[model samples]
Target: METFSSIECFVRSAEVGSFAEAARRLSLTPAAVGKSVAKLEARLGVRLFQRSTRSLTLTEAGQLFLREVGSSFNTIQNAVANLASAGGQPAGTLKVSMGTAFGRLFVVPLLGEFLRRYPAINPDWHFDNRQVDLIGQGFDAAIGGGFELPQGVVARKLTVAHRVLVASEGYLQNHAAITEPQDLAHHQGILIRSPQTGRVRSWQLTNRNREHSPLMLKARMTMSDSEADCAAAAQGLGIGLVSMPIAIPFLESGGLQRVLPDWYVDDGNISIYYAEHKLLPGKTRAFVDFIIEQFAEQGLAQRFSAV
Candidate 1:
Protein backbone atom coordinates (compact mmCIF):
# COMPACT_ATOMS: atom_id res chain seq x y z
CA MET A 1 0.00 0.00 0.00
CA GLU A 2 1.22 3.51 -0.83
CA THR A 3 1.44 6.05 1.96
CA PHE A 4 -0.75 9.14 1.57
CA SER A 5 2.10 11.47 2.55
CA SER A 6 4.37 10.12 -0.15
CA ILE A 7 1.59 10.35 -2.76
CA GLU A 8 0.84 13.94 -1.74
CA CYS A 9 4.49 14.94 -2.05
CA PHE A 10 4.81 13.28 -5.45
CA VAL A 11 1.68 15.04 -6.72
CA ARG A 12 2.95 18.42 -5.58
CA SER A 13 6.37 17.85 -7.13
CA ALA A 14 4.85 16.78 -10.44
CA GLU A 15 2.38 19.67 -10.52
CA VAL A 16 5.07 22.27 -9.77
CA GLY A 17 7.68 20.58 -12.02
CA SER A 18 10.35 20.81 -9.32
CA PHE A 19 11.14 19.35 -5.94
CA ALA A 20 12.20 22.72 -4.56
CA GLU A 21 8.83 24.27 -5.41
CA ALA A 22 6.95 21.35 -3.91
CA ALA A 23 9.11 21.58 -0.77
CA ARG A 24 8.43 25.29 -0.49
CA ARG A 25 4.68 24.68 -0.82
CA LEU A 26 4.69 21.85 1.71
CA SER A 27 6.91 23.68 4.21
CA LEU A 28 9.60 21.05 3.83
CA THR A 29 13.16 20.99 2.45
CA PRO A 30 14.15 19.93 -1.05
CA ALA A 31 16.04 16.98 0.37
CA ALA A 32 12.89 15.89 2.15
CA VAL A 33 10.86 16.00 -1.03
CA GLY A 34 13.56 14.00 -2.79
CA LYS A 35 13.57 11.46 0.02
CA SER A 36 9.81 11.06 -0.11
CA VAL A 37 9.91 10.46 -3.87
CA ALA A 38 12.72 7.98 -3.43
CA LYS A 39 10.76 6.15 -0.77
CA LEU A 40 7.69 6.01 -2.95
CA GLU A 41 9.76 4.72 -5.88
CA ALA A 42 11.30 2.05 -3.67
CA ARG A 43 7.89 0.92 -2.48
CA LEU A 44 6.48 0.77 -5.99
CA GLY A 45 9.69 -0.79 -7.37
CA VAL A 46 9.59 1.50 -10.39
CA ARG A 47 11.38 4.75 -11.18
CA LEU A 48 8.76 7.51 -11.27
CA PHE A 49 10.87 10.57 -12.08
CA GLN A 50 13.88 11.12 -14.27
CA ARG A 51 15.94 13.37 -12.02
CA SER A 52 18.31 15.74 -13.81
CA THR A 53 20.41 18.56 -12.50
CA ARG A 54 18.25 21.13 -14.31
CA SER A 55 14.86 19.48 -14.59
CA LEU A 56 12.48 16.81 -13.29
CA THR A 57 10.62 14.66 -15.79
CA LEU A 58 8.18 11.87 -15.11
CA THR A 59 9.21 8.43 -16.35
CA GLU A 60 6.77 6.38 -18.47
CA ALA A 61 5.78 4.36 -15.46
CA GLY A 62 5.61 7.47 -13.34
CA GLN A 63 3.40 9.24 -15.87
CA LEU A 64 0.99 6.32 -15.88
CA PHE A 65 0.98 6.18 -12.11
CA LEU A 66 0.34 9.91 -11.83
CA ARG A 67 -2.63 9.72 -14.17
CA GLU A 68 -4.12 6.98 -12.03
CA VAL A 69 -3.14 8.40 -8.66
CA GLY A 70 -3.73 12.07 -9.13
CA SER A 71 -7.52 11.65 -9.18
CA SER A 72 -7.38 9.52 -6.06
CA PHE A 73 -5.24 12.10 -4.27
CA ASN A 74 -7.65 14.84 -5.24
CA THR A 75 -10.51 12.72 -3.96
CA ILE A 76 -8.81 12.29 -0.59
CA GLN A 77 -8.15 16.01 -0.39
CA ASN A 78 -11.78 16.79 -1.13
CA ALA A 79 -12.90 14.26 1.42
CA VAL A 80 -10.84 16.00 4.03
CA ALA A 81 -12.31 19.31 3.02
CA ASN A 82 -15.82 17.95 3.27
CA LEU A 83 -15.16 16.70 6.79
CA ALA A 84 -13.63 20.01 7.86
CA SER A 85 -16.49 22.03 6.42
CA ALA A 86 -18.99 19.76 8.13
CA GLY A 87 -17.28 20.34 11.47
CA GLY A 88 -18.16 24.05 11.16
CA GLN A 89 -14.86 25.11 12.68
CA PRO A 90 -13.00 26.43 9.67
CA ALA A 91 -9.28 26.62 10.46
CA GLY A 92 -6.45 26.37 7.96
CA THR A 93 -4.28 28.33 5.57
CA LEU A 94 -6.04 29.58 2.45
CA LYS A 95 -3.98 30.67 -0.52
CA VAL A 96 -5.53 33.26 -2.86
CA SER A 97 -4.44 35.07 -6.03
CA MET A 98 -5.94 38.35 -7.23
CA GLY A 99 -5.35 41.38 -9.43
CA THR A 100 -3.39 44.18 -7.75
CA ALA A 101 -6.03 46.91 -8.07
CA PHE A 102 -9.08 44.96 -6.86
CA GLY A 103 -7.14 43.22 -4.11
CA ARG A 104 -5.89 46.55 -2.79
CA LEU A 105 -9.21 48.37 -2.99
CA PHE A 106 -11.58 45.62 -1.84
CA VAL A 107 -10.21 42.27 -0.63
CA VAL A 108 -7.29 43.46 1.51
CA PRO A 109 -9.37 45.87 3.58
CA LEU A 110 -11.96 43.24 4.53
CA LEU A 111 -9.34 40.67 5.52
CA GLY A 112 -9.24 41.93 9.07
CA GLU A 113 -12.94 41.36 9.54
CA PHE A 114 -12.60 37.82 8.17
CA LEU A 115 -9.79 37.13 10.59
CA ARG A 116 -11.84 38.51 13.42
CA ARG A 117 -14.66 36.15 12.54
CA TYR A 118 -12.46 33.12 12.07
CA PRO A 119 -9.34 33.70 14.08
CA ALA A 120 -8.06 30.21 13.38
CA ILE A 121 -7.92 30.74 9.63
CA ASN A 122 -4.85 32.36 8.08
CA PRO A 123 -4.79 33.79 4.57
CA ASP A 124 -1.86 33.93 2.19
CA TRP A 125 -2.52 36.31 -0.68
CA HIS A 126 -0.66 37.16 -3.87
CA PHE A 127 -1.56 40.20 -5.98
CA ASP A 128 -0.31 40.64 -9.52
CA ASN A 129 -1.52 41.74 -12.94
CA ARG A 130 -0.62 38.40 -14.50
CA GLN A 131 -3.02 35.49 -14.85
CA VAL A 132 -1.52 32.58 -12.92
CA ASP A 133 -2.04 28.82 -13.11
CA LEU A 134 -3.97 28.09 -9.95
CA ILE A 135 -3.25 24.35 -9.67
CA GLY A 136 0.34 24.55 -10.77
CA GLN A 137 1.00 27.44 -8.40
CA GLY A 138 -0.89 25.65 -5.59
CA PHE A 139 -3.25 28.53 -4.92
CA ASP A 140 -6.57 27.64 -3.27
CA ALA A 141 -8.52 30.14 -5.38
CA ALA A 142 -8.21 33.21 -7.59
CA ILE A 143 -10.22 36.44 -7.91
CA GLY A 144 -10.52 37.50 -11.51
CA GLY A 145 -12.29 40.16 -13.59
CA GLY A 146 -14.15 39.30 -16.81
CA PHE A 147 -16.05 36.09 -17.52
CA GLU A 148 -13.60 33.97 -19.45
CA LEU A 149 -11.94 31.30 -17.30
CA PRO A 150 -9.52 28.49 -17.98
CA GLN A 151 -11.04 25.09 -18.65
CA GLY A 152 -11.56 22.77 -15.65
CA VAL A 153 -11.84 25.55 -13.08
CA VAL A 154 -15.10 26.48 -11.31
CA ALA A 155 -15.99 30.15 -10.96
CA ARG A 156 -18.39 31.86 -8.57
CA LYS A 157 -19.50 35.38 -9.46
CA LEU A 158 -18.33 38.01 -6.98
CA THR A 159 -19.09 41.52 -8.27
CA VAL A 160 -20.05 43.39 -11.41
CA ALA A 161 -17.91 46.25 -12.70
CA HIS A 162 -18.69 48.67 -15.51
CA ARG A 163 -15.98 49.90 -17.78
CA VAL A 164 -16.10 53.66 -18.38
CA LEU A 165 -14.06 56.08 -20.46
CA VAL A 166 -12.74 58.72 -18.08
CA ALA A 167 -10.56 61.79 -18.48
CA SER A 168 -9.43 64.72 -16.36
CA GLU A 169 -11.32 67.99 -16.74
CA GLY A 170 -8.13 69.65 -17.93
CA TYR A 171 -7.53 67.10 -20.68
CA LEU A 172 -11.09 67.27 -21.97
CA GLN A 173 -11.07 71.07 -21.84
CA ASN A 174 -7.81 71.34 -23.79
CA HIS A 175 -8.69 68.72 -26.43
CA ALA A 176 -11.36 68.78 -29.17
CA ALA A 177 -14.95 68.74 -27.90
CA ILE A 178 -16.09 65.13 -27.32
CA THR A 179 -19.56 63.98 -28.34
CA GLU A 180 -19.28 60.40 -29.51
CA PRO A 181 -17.10 57.24 -29.25
CA GLN A 182 -15.51 58.13 -32.61
CA ASP A 183 -14.08 61.25 -30.98
CA LEU A 184 -11.77 58.98 -28.91
CA ALA A 185 -9.71 58.26 -32.03
CA HIS A 186 -8.69 61.93 -32.26
CA HIS A 187 -7.38 62.13 -28.68
CA GLN A 188 -4.56 60.49 -26.78
CA GLY A 189 -5.82 57.33 -25.11
CA ILE A 190 -4.37 55.21 -22.34
CA LEU A 191 -4.53 51.50 -23.08
CA ILE A 192 -4.49 48.59 -20.64
CA ARG A 193 -3.09 45.22 -21.70
CA SER A 194 -5.17 42.24 -20.66
CA PRO A 195 -3.11 40.07 -18.36
CA GLN A 196 -4.83 36.84 -19.35
CA THR A 197 -4.97 37.23 -23.11
CA GLY A 198 -1.89 39.43 -23.65
CA ARG A 199 -3.93 41.70 -25.91
CA VAL A 200 -4.87 45.36 -25.84
CA ARG A 201 -8.24 45.87 -24.14
CA SER A 202 -11.04 47.87 -25.76
CA TRP A 203 -13.97 49.59 -24.17
CA GLN A 204 -17.31 47.70 -24.60
CA LEU A 205 -19.86 50.48 -24.53
CA THR A 206 -23.65 50.18 -24.53
CA ASN A 207 -26.20 52.86 -25.40
CA ARG A 208 -29.15 53.93 -23.22
CA ASN A 209 -31.24 50.91 -24.25
CA ARG A 210 -28.14 48.66 -23.83
CA GLU A 211 -27.17 48.39 -27.52
CA HIS A 212 -23.41 47.79 -27.27
CA SER A 213 -20.26 47.92 -29.36
CA PRO A 214 -16.52 47.86 -28.78
CA LEU A 215 -15.21 51.43 -28.96
CA MET A 216 -11.69 51.12 -30.29
CA LEU A 217 -9.38 53.99 -29.38
CA LYS A 218 -5.95 54.87 -30.64
CA ALA A 219 -3.38 54.19 -27.95
CA ARG A 220 -0.88 56.95 -27.25
CA MET A 221 0.47 55.26 -24.12
CA THR A 222 0.05 51.75 -22.77
CA MET A 223 0.07 50.73 -19.12
CA SER A 224 -0.12 47.30 -17.48
CA ASP A 225 -1.47 48.56 -14.18
CA SER A 226 -5.11 49.72 -13.92
CA GLU A 227 -4.34 52.01 -10.99
CA ALA A 228 -1.56 53.67 -12.97
CA ASP A 229 -3.96 54.13 -15.87
CA CYS A 230 -6.41 55.87 -13.53
CA ALA A 231 -3.62 58.05 -12.14
CA ALA A 232 -2.48 59.04 -15.63
CA ALA A 233 -6.01 60.02 -16.57
CA ALA A 234 -6.28 62.04 -13.35
CA GLN A 235 -3.05 63.87 -14.23
CA GLY A 236 -4.57 64.87 -17.60
CA LEU A 237 -2.21 62.59 -19.50
CA GLY A 238 -4.95 60.88 -21.54
CA ILE A 239 -8.43 59.44 -21.54
CA GLY A 240 -8.61 55.94 -20.03
CA LEU A 241 -11.15 53.15 -19.92
CA VAL A 242 -11.20 51.90 -16.36
CA SER A 243 -13.33 49.73 -14.10
CA MET A 244 -16.01 51.54 -12.11
CA PRO A 245 -14.70 50.71 -8.63
CA ILE A 246 -11.24 51.99 -9.48
CA ALA A 247 -12.61 55.14 -11.16
CA ILE A 248 -15.23 55.89 -8.48
CA PRO A 249 -13.05 57.84 -6.05
CA PHE A 250 -11.62 60.00 -8.85
CA LEU A 251 -15.12 60.66 -10.25
CA GLU A 252 -16.36 61.67 -6.79
CA SER A 253 -13.33 63.93 -6.26
CA GLY A 254 -13.80 65.62 -9.65
CA GLY A 255 -10.34 64.43 -10.68
CA LEU A 256 -11.82 62.28 -13.42
CA GLN A 257 -15.05 62.67 -15.39
CA ARG A 258 -17.06 60.01 -17.20
CA VAL A 259 -17.18 60.78 -20.91
CA LEU A 260 -20.23 58.79 -22.12
CA PRO A 261 -22.90 58.97 -19.44
CA ASP A 262 -25.59 57.32 -21.55
CA TRP A 263 -23.29 54.54 -22.70
CA TYR A 264 -22.25 51.76 -20.28
CA VAL A 265 -19.71 48.98 -20.59
CA ASP A 266 -20.00 45.61 -18.98
CA ASP A 267 -16.74 44.38 -17.52
CA GLY A 268 -18.71 41.42 -16.25
CA ASN A 269 -18.98 40.25 -12.66
CA ILE A 270 -15.79 39.63 -10.72
CA SER A 271 -15.51 35.97 -9.77
CA ILE A 272 -13.83 33.78 -7.20
CA TYR A 273 -12.60 30.68 -9.03
CA TYR A 274 -11.17 27.43 -7.82
CA ALA A 275 -10.47 23.92 -9.01
CA GLU A 276 -13.64 21.93 -9.63
CA HIS A 277 -13.06 19.31 -7.00
CA LYS A 278 -15.34 17.90 -4.32
CA LEU A 279 -13.09 18.77 -1.42
CA LEU A 280 -12.49 22.40 -0.66
CA PRO A 281 -10.61 23.06 2.56
CA GLY A 282 -12.16 24.77 5.57
CA LYS A 283 -10.15 27.94 5.12
CA THR A 284 -11.04 28.32 1.44
CA ARG A 285 -14.75 27.92 2.06
CA ALA A 286 -14.70 30.41 4.92
CA PHE A 287 -12.80 33.02 2.94
CA VAL A 288 -15.15 32.66 -0.05
CA ASP A 289 -18.17 33.13 2.20
CA PHE A 290 -16.54 36.06 3.95
CA ILE A 291 -15.75 37.77 0.65
CA ILE A 292 -19.30 37.25 -0.54
CA GLU A 293 -20.66 38.83 2.62
CA GLN A 294 -18.25 41.74 2.47
CA PHE A 295 -19.12 42.55 -1.13
CA ALA A 296 -22.81 42.46 -0.19
CA GLU A 297 -22.38 44.95 2.61
CA GLN A 298 -20.27 47.14 0.34
CA GLY A 299 -23.16 47.43 -2.20
CA LEU A 300 -21.35 45.09 -4.60
CA ALA A 301 -23.63 42.30 -3.34
CA GLN A 302 -25.46 41.57 -6.57
CA ARG A 303 -22.24 40.53 -8.19
CA PHE A 304 -21.29 37.64 -5.89
CA SER A 305 -24.31 37.15 -3.64
CA ALA A 306 -25.47 34.01 -5.40
CA VAL A 307 -22.49 32.02 -4.15
Candidate 2:
Protein backbone atom coordinates (compact mmCIF):
# COMPACT_ATOMS: atom_id res chain seq x y z
CA MET A 1 0.00 0.00 0.00
CA GLU A 2 2.85 2.40 0.87
CA THR A 3 4.67 1.35 -2.30
CA PHE A 4 1.58 2.11 -4.36
CA SER A 5 1.16 5.52 -2.72
CA SER A 6 4.82 6.37 -3.41
CA ILE A 7 4.47 5.33 -7.04
CA GLU A 8 1.33 7.45 -7.42
CA CYS A 9 3.17 10.39 -5.88
CA PHE A 10 6.04 9.87 -8.30
CA VAL A 11 3.74 9.55 -11.33
CA ARG A 12 1.76 12.65 -10.37
CA SER A 13 4.99 14.61 -9.80
CA ALA A 14 6.24 13.55 -13.24
CA GLU A 15 2.99 14.57 -14.91
CA VAL A 16 2.90 18.14 -13.53
CA GLY A 17 6.70 18.58 -13.19
CA SER A 18 6.18 20.01 -9.67
CA PHE A 19 5.87 18.33 -6.31
CA ALA A 20 3.83 21.25 -5.00
CA GLU A 21 1.33 21.04 -7.83
CA ALA A 22 1.16 17.26 -7.51
CA ALA A 23 0.60 17.64 -3.79
CA ARG A 24 -2.30 20.02 -4.43
CA ARG A 25 -3.92 17.44 -6.67
CA LEU A 26 -3.24 14.67 -4.20
CA SER A 27 -4.49 16.80 -1.25
CA LEU A 28 -1.10 16.39 0.49
CA THR A 29 1.61 18.76 1.63
CA PRO A 30 4.60 19.35 -0.66
CA ALA A 31 6.93 17.94 1.99
CA ALA A 32 4.86 14.75 2.18
CA VAL A 33 4.92 14.39 -1.60
CA GLY A 34 8.69 14.95 -1.62
CA LYS A 35 9.15 12.40 1.17
CA SER A 36 7.06 9.82 -0.71
CA VAL A 37 9.08 10.36 -3.90
CA ALA A 38 12.29 10.06 -1.87
CA LYS A 39 11.10 6.76 -0.41
CA LEU A 40 10.27 5.50 -3.91
CA GLU A 41 13.73 6.57 -5.12
CA ALA A 42 15.45 4.86 -2.19
CA ARG A 43 13.50 1.65 -2.74
CA LEU A 44 14.20 1.64 -6.48
CA GLY A 45 17.80 2.85 -6.00
CA VAL A 46 17.40 5.37 -8.87
CA ARG A 47 17.08 9.13 -8.81
CA LEU A 48 13.85 10.22 -10.53
CA PHE A 49 14.01 13.99 -10.62
CA GLN A 50 16.83 16.51 -10.93
CA ARG A 51 16.37 18.81 -7.93
CA SER A 52 16.30 22.53 -8.76
CA THR A 53 15.27 25.81 -7.27
CA ARG A 54 12.97 26.98 -10.05
CA SER A 55 12.10 23.92 -12.12
CA LEU A 56 11.70 20.14 -11.78
CA THR A 57 13.06 17.89 -14.52
CA LEU A 58 12.94 14.13 -14.85
CA THR A 59 16.18 12.18 -15.09
CA GLU A 60 16.63 9.69 -17.95
CA ALA A 61 15.84 6.75 -15.65
CA GLY A 62 12.84 8.64 -14.23
CA GLN A 63 11.44 9.29 -17.70
CA LEU A 64 11.89 5.63 -18.60
CA PHE A 65 10.18 4.49 -15.41
CA LEU A 66 7.34 6.95 -15.95
CA ARG A 67 6.76 5.68 -19.46
CA GLU A 68 6.67 2.12 -18.17
CA VAL A 69 4.41 2.69 -15.18
CA GLY A 70 2.22 5.74 -15.78
CA SER A 71 -0.51 4.04 -17.76
CA SER A 72 -0.41 0.95 -15.57
CA PHE A 73 -0.74 3.03 -12.43
CA ASN A 74 -3.73 4.86 -13.88
CA THR A 75 -5.39 1.58 -14.74
CA ILE A 76 -4.86 0.31 -11.21
CA GLN A 77 -6.32 3.52 -9.79
CA ASN A 78 -9.34 3.22 -12.06
CA ALA A 79 -9.87 -0.35 -10.96
CA VAL A 80 -9.79 0.68 -7.35
CA ALA A 81 -12.15 3.57 -8.01
CA ASN A 82 -14.46 1.17 -9.82
CA LEU A 83 -14.66 -1.09 -6.78
CA ALA A 84 -15.25 1.83 -4.48
CA SER A 85 -17.91 3.26 -6.76
CA ALA A 86 -19.84 0.00 -6.80
CA GLY A 87 -20.31 0.13 -3.05
CA GLY A 88 -20.29 3.86 -2.29
CA GLN A 89 -22.34 6.88 -3.26
CA PRO A 90 -21.03 9.39 -5.79
CA ALA A 91 -19.38 11.80 -3.35
CA GLY A 92 -16.45 14.19 -3.81
CA THR A 93 -15.39 17.47 -5.34
CA LEU A 94 -16.24 17.24 -9.05
CA LYS A 95 -13.76 19.53 -10.75
CA VAL A 96 -14.78 20.69 -14.23
CA SER A 97 -13.72 23.28 -16.81
CA MET A 98 -15.97 25.08 -19.27
CA GLY A 99 -16.43 28.28 -21.25
CA THR A 100 -17.36 31.35 -19.21
CA ALA A 101 -20.68 32.27 -20.80
CA PHE A 102 -21.66 28.78 -21.84
CA GLY A 103 -21.17 27.45 -18.34
CA ARG A 104 -23.16 30.28 -16.81
CA LEU A 105 -26.00 30.26 -19.35
CA PHE A 106 -26.41 26.55 -19.96
CA VAL A 107 -24.69 24.35 -17.39
CA VAL A 108 -25.04 26.59 -14.35
CA PRO A 109 -28.80 26.67 -14.58
CA LEU A 110 -28.96 22.93 -14.05
CA LEU A 111 -26.76 22.92 -10.94
CA GLY A 112 -29.59 23.16 -8.46
CA GLU A 113 -31.36 20.11 -9.82
CA PHE A 114 -28.11 18.23 -10.16
CA LEU A 115 -27.19 18.87 -6.55
CA ARG A 116 -30.59 17.76 -5.44
CA ARG A 117 -30.02 14.44 -7.16
CA TYR A 118 -26.50 13.97 -5.81
CA PRO A 119 -26.28 15.84 -2.57
CA ALA A 120 -23.00 14.26 -1.62
CA ILE A 121 -21.19 15.55 -4.71
CA ASN A 122 -19.77 19.06 -4.64
CA PRO A 123 -19.07 21.07 -7.75
CA ASP A 124 -15.76 22.84 -8.35
CA TRP A 125 -16.01 24.31 -11.81
CA HIS A 126 -13.65 26.67 -13.65
CA PHE A 127 -14.93 28.96 -16.38
CA ASP A 128 -12.46 30.04 -19.06
CA ASN A 129 -12.23 30.31 -22.83
CA ARG A 130 -9.33 27.92 -23.32
CA GLN A 131 -8.48 24.26 -23.38
CA VAL A 132 -7.49 22.64 -20.07
CA ASP A 133 -5.06 19.88 -19.21
CA LEU A 134 -7.55 17.39 -17.72
CA ILE A 135 -5.17 14.85 -16.18
CA GLY A 136 -2.27 17.09 -15.31
CA GLN A 137 -4.51 19.78 -13.87
CA GLY A 138 -6.72 17.25 -12.04
CA PHE A 139 -9.98 18.27 -13.67
CA ASP A 140 -12.60 15.53 -13.59
CA ALA A 141 -14.14 16.84 -16.82
CA ALA A 142 -14.19 19.72 -19.30
CA ILE A 143 -16.92 21.09 -21.57
CA GLY A 144 -16.03 22.85 -24.79
CA GLY A 145 -15.08 22.32 -28.42
CA GLY A 146 -11.96 21.57 -30.46
CA PHE A 147 -9.81 19.87 -27.83
CA GLU A 148 -6.87 17.74 -28.92
CA LEU A 149 -7.64 14.63 -26.87
CA PRO A 150 -4.82 13.47 -24.63
CA GLN A 151 -3.78 9.79 -24.44
CA GLY A 152 -6.41 8.68 -21.91
CA VAL A 153 -9.10 11.28 -22.53
CA VAL A 154 -12.37 10.97 -24.45
CA ALA A 155 -15.07 13.38 -25.62
CA ARG A 156 -18.85 13.10 -25.62
CA LYS A 157 -20.33 15.68 -27.96
CA LEU A 158 -23.27 17.80 -26.78
CA THR A 159 -24.11 20.22 -29.61
CA VAL A 160 -22.87 21.49 -32.95
CA ALA A 161 -20.62 24.56 -32.66
CA HIS A 162 -22.48 26.48 -35.30
CA ARG A 163 -22.04 30.23 -35.72
CA VAL A 164 -24.80 32.37 -37.25
CA LEU A 165 -25.04 36.00 -38.22
CA VAL A 166 -26.99 38.08 -35.71
CA ALA A 167 -27.84 41.75 -35.24
CA SER A 168 -30.30 43.91 -33.33
CA GLU A 169 -33.64 44.68 -35.04
CA GLY A 170 -32.70 48.36 -34.93
CA TYR A 171 -29.44 47.73 -36.72
CA LEU A 172 -31.17 45.60 -39.36
CA GLN A 173 -33.82 48.27 -39.84
CA ASN A 174 -31.21 51.03 -40.25
CA HIS A 175 -28.93 49.09 -42.60
CA ALA A 176 -29.96 47.69 -45.95
CA ALA A 177 -31.57 44.27 -45.55
CA ILE A 178 -28.94 41.57 -45.97
CA THR A 179 -30.74 38.93 -48.02
CA GLU A 180 -27.57 37.30 -49.33
CA PRO A 181 -23.98 36.80 -48.18
CA GLN A 182 -22.66 39.36 -50.63
CA ASP A 183 -25.02 42.02 -49.21
CA LEU A 184 -23.18 41.62 -45.86
CA ALA A 185 -20.23 43.54 -47.32
CA HIS A 186 -22.31 46.74 -47.19
CA HIS A 187 -23.01 46.37 -43.43
CA GLN A 188 -20.97 46.91 -40.29
CA GLY A 189 -19.54 43.79 -38.56
CA ILE A 190 -18.57 42.78 -35.05
CA LEU A 191 -15.69 40.33 -35.44
CA ILE A 192 -14.18 37.87 -32.98
CA ARG A 193 -10.43 37.59 -32.52
CA SER A 194 -9.14 34.10 -32.07
CA PRO A 195 -7.51 33.74 -28.65
CA GLN A 196 -5.23 30.94 -29.86
CA THR A 197 -4.03 32.81 -33.00
CA GLY A 198 -4.26 36.45 -31.88
CA ARG A 199 -5.91 37.32 -35.20
CA VAL A 200 -9.46 37.91 -36.38
CA ARG A 201 -11.30 34.72 -37.23
CA SER A 202 -12.36 34.23 -40.84
CA TRP A 203 -14.85 31.64 -42.03
CA GLN A 204 -17.19 30.96 -44.89
CA LEU A 205 -20.94 30.54 -44.47
CA THR A 206 -22.31 27.24 -45.74
CA ASN A 207 -25.97 26.40 -46.17
CA ARG A 208 -28.05 23.24 -46.56
CA ASN A 209 -27.44 23.07 -50.32
CA ARG A 210 -23.68 23.04 -49.65
CA GLU A 211 -23.14 26.44 -51.22
CA HIS A 212 -20.35 28.48 -49.59
CA SER A 213 -20.03 32.25 -49.22
CA PRO A 214 -17.18 34.20 -47.65
CA LEU A 215 -17.98 36.49 -44.72
CA MET A 216 -17.15 39.98 -45.98
CA LEU A 217 -18.29 42.88 -43.81
CA LYS A 218 -16.79 46.11 -42.52
CA ALA A 219 -15.15 45.39 -39.16
CA ARG A 220 -16.78 47.97 -36.89
CA MET A 221 -15.67 46.23 -33.70
CA THR A 222 -13.46 43.33 -32.77
CA MET A 223 -13.34 41.37 -29.52
CA SER A 224 -11.96 38.06 -28.23
CA ASP A 225 -15.09 36.81 -26.48
CA SER A 226 -18.20 35.34 -28.10
CA GLU A 227 -20.44 36.77 -25.39
CA ALA A 228 -18.98 40.22 -26.04
CA ASP A 229 -19.71 39.78 -29.72
CA CYS A 230 -23.32 38.91 -28.89
CA ALA A 231 -23.56 41.93 -26.61
CA ALA A 232 -22.11 44.21 -29.26
CA ALA A 233 -24.62 42.93 -31.80
CA ALA A 234 -27.48 43.26 -29.30
CA GLN A 235 -26.53 46.88 -28.66
CA GLY A 236 -26.93 47.59 -32.40
CA LEU A 237 -23.20 48.01 -33.04
CA GLY A 238 -23.03 45.60 -35.99
CA ILE A 239 -23.97 42.20 -37.30
CA GLY A 240 -21.90 39.63 -35.42
CA LEU A 241 -21.19 36.00 -36.14
CA VAL A 242 -21.79 34.13 -32.88
CA SER A 243 -21.96 30.51 -31.83
CA MET A 244 -25.50 29.29 -31.13
CA PRO A 245 -24.77 28.46 -27.49
CA ILE A 246 -23.68 32.03 -26.75
CA ALA A 247 -26.25 33.77 -28.97
CA ILE A 248 -29.36 31.87 -27.89
CA PRO A 249 -30.31 34.02 -24.91
CA PHE A 250 -30.13 37.34 -26.78
CA LEU A 251 -32.14 35.88 -29.64
CA GLU A 252 -34.69 34.46 -27.19
CA SER A 253 -35.27 37.84 -25.53
CA GLY A 254 -35.58 39.49 -28.96
CA GLY A 255 -32.53 41.62 -28.22
CA LEU A 256 -30.97 40.15 -31.38
CA GLN A 257 -32.30 38.52 -34.48
CA ARG A 258 -30.63 36.12 -36.87
CA VAL A 259 -29.71 37.55 -40.28
CA LEU A 260 -29.46 35.23 -43.28
CA PRO A 261 -30.58 32.49 -40.90
CA ASP A 262 -30.16 29.71 -43.45
CA TRP A 263 -26.40 30.01 -43.58
CA TYR A 264 -23.95 29.30 -40.76
CA VAL A 265 -20.29 28.56 -40.07
CA ASP A 266 -19.63 25.14 -38.63
CA ASP A 267 -16.69 25.31 -36.24
CA GLY A 268 -17.02 21.87 -34.67
CA ASN A 269 -18.93 20.11 -31.87
CA ILE A 270 -19.29 21.21 -28.26
CA SER A 271 -18.33 18.24 -26.15
CA ILE A 272 -17.84 17.16 -22.56
CA TYR A 273 -14.36 15.70 -22.21
CA TYR A 274 -13.12 13.38 -19.51
CA ALA A 275 -10.54 10.72 -18.84
CA GLU A 276 -11.26 7.45 -20.68
CA HIS A 277 -11.73 4.91 -17.98
CA LYS A 278 -14.19 2.02 -18.06
CA LEU A 279 -15.01 2.48 -14.41
CA LEU A 280 -15.20 6.26 -14.48
CA PRO A 281 -15.69 8.18 -11.24
CA GLY A 282 -19.30 8.18 -10.12
CA LYS A 283 -19.40 11.97 -9.86
CA THR A 284 -18.05 12.44 -13.39
CA ARG A 285 -20.35 9.83 -14.87
CA ALA A 286 -23.33 11.37 -13.11
CA PHE A 287 -22.57 14.86 -14.39
CA VAL A 288 -21.92 13.71 -17.95
CA ASP A 289 -25.13 11.68 -18.02
CA PHE A 290 -27.18 14.53 -16.58
CA ILE A 291 -25.84 17.03 -19.09
CA ILE A 292 -26.44 14.69 -22.00
CA GLU A 293 -29.98 14.04 -20.80
CA GLN A 294 -30.70 17.75 -20.49
CA PHE A 295 -29.27 18.56 -23.90
CA ALA A 296 -31.27 15.77 -25.49
CA GLU A 297 -34.44 16.88 -23.76
CA GLN A 298 -33.95 20.46 -24.90
CA GLY A 299 -33.17 19.34 -28.50
CA LEU A 300 -30.05 21.49 -28.40
CA ALA A 301 -28.48 19.64 -31.34
CA GLN A 302 -31.42 20.35 -33.62
CA ARG A 303 -31.85 23.91 -32.37
CA PHE A 304 -28.13 24.65 -32.78
CA SER A 305 -27.98 23.29 -36.32
CA ALA A 306 -28.00 25.89 -39.07
CA VAL A 307 -29.21 23.55 -41.75
Query: Highest TM-score among the candidates is held by which one?
Result: 2
Off by over 4 Å in 1: 81-88, 196-199, 202-204, 213-216, 301-307
Superposition-based RMSD of candidate 1 using all C-alpha atoms, in angstroms: 3.4
Summarize candidate 1's per-residue lDDT along 17-93 as a digit string, tens digits.
Answer: 89999999889999999999999999999999999999999999999999999988898887676566424777777
Query: Lowest-lDDT window of 10 residues in candidate 2?
Result: 78-87
| Residue range 1-307, candidate 2, lDDT tens digits | 9999999999999989899999998999999999999999999999999989999899999999999998788878876754564237677789999999989988899999999888888899999888988987889999998678889899999988999899999999998988899999999999888776778877888987889989897788898888999998988999998888888888889999999988999898999999987678778889999999999998888877767
Task: Name the TM-score of candidate 2.
Answer: 0.93
lDDT of 1 at 212: 70
In terms of lDDT, the best-performing candidate is 2
